[model samples]
Target: MSNNIKNIVYRTLSKAWATLLEINYDYRFKDGTWKRISRESYDRGHGTGILLYNVDKGTIILTKQFRMPIYHTNKDEAMSIEVCAGAIDDNDLPESTIIREVEEEVGYLVKDVKKVMETYMSPGALTEKMYLYVAPYSEEMKVNEGGGLASEHEEIEVMEIPFSKALEMMVSGEILDAKTVILLQYAQINDLIKNRE
Candidate 1:
């Protein structure tokens, strides 16, 4: 409800996997002039992402899954490597959502997680605020062979790679997911895991 904005109108364009809305609004510029603008926003809601690292083992857990949008753009590299993440439910907080996703997606029952940052995956067109976290993981913490949920039609490949290798992948453009790259870089900056042998 800023004075700079007025005469807002919203229309739903589609509602399936995510809600698409058409918006029209009047904006008052710094010159004291007003202009009417129309735009569309895709609302898939907020989500959380966590990067699990093993300090002693010098390794990290990542997931590989097929992204339809990425598939549309890069057919050869449709399988995207990313941190464990999931959409936040209306009833759930960011921390809880990530914890549950870690367990469901990576098969790790991690209770203590340190939130690193919150980011918008794509601010321009999609309204998805990503809560990023880092957590310590060990072999004992793993509860199952997580490949994602069948009900959600998620087919994920769990990866346990060395920290240095993860960094190399990031630099080589193998880790294309922005959230995953950010969390990996956070781990590197914070020395969460051993960078070299």
Candidate 2:
């Protein structure tokens, strides 16, 4: 693999909330030839997402918010329904980041969370690894009214829906986010909801 890589050059395209770079590289083909390629990649760092479930209620917590990128591409479908998620800051681990995001986005203070999976959300054009988690929540965990942080322009609307209904939405395309869909499917396939009941 090392011998196949000839050269790699990274050029910065933008450095806003996320860093965008134009990558130029040379690869040695199997037929003993070299090919140059250029690709653009967005680096937003790693992130964490959590699916909060209430076993007694047979429901899961979700959040709705406007995504500008989605809005620009599909005006009709601007708002996204997603599980509680946030980018992991430099100082915090994935576990702590998701815990804090859960409380801030859904008003649930979860102490025990299980890390289920790790995935590269969009490896083709973005450099972001998402740590997926699941946590149990009860009524007592709701200590505050969570709508996300106003300073970050997060206007999230918390929603609690039955696990079955969330599955239906996933099939019907109402729930479009990739990470959210993965967690919901994981919950169903693993009988997480049924076991709770």
Candidates in order, TM-scores: namely: 0.97, 0.97
**Colliding pairs, model 2:** none
Q: Give the TM-score of candidate 2.
A: 0.97
> Number of backbone collisions per candidate, in order?
0, 0
**Where is model 2 poorest over a 10-residue stretch in terms of lDDT?**
188-197
Q: Find the candidate with the highest lDDT and give its number.
A: 2
- Give the C-alpha lDDT of model 1: 0.92
Q: What is the C-alpha lDDT profile of model 2 across 1-197, one tens digit per residue?
A: 99998689999999998899999999998998999999999999999999998888899999999999999999777889999999999979999999999989889899999999999999999899999999999998998989999998899999998998999889999999999999999999998885332
The residue pairs found clashing in candidate 1 are none
Give per-residue lDDT, candidate 2, residue 136.
Answer: 93
Q: Residue 84 deviation, candidate 2, in Å?
A: 0.3
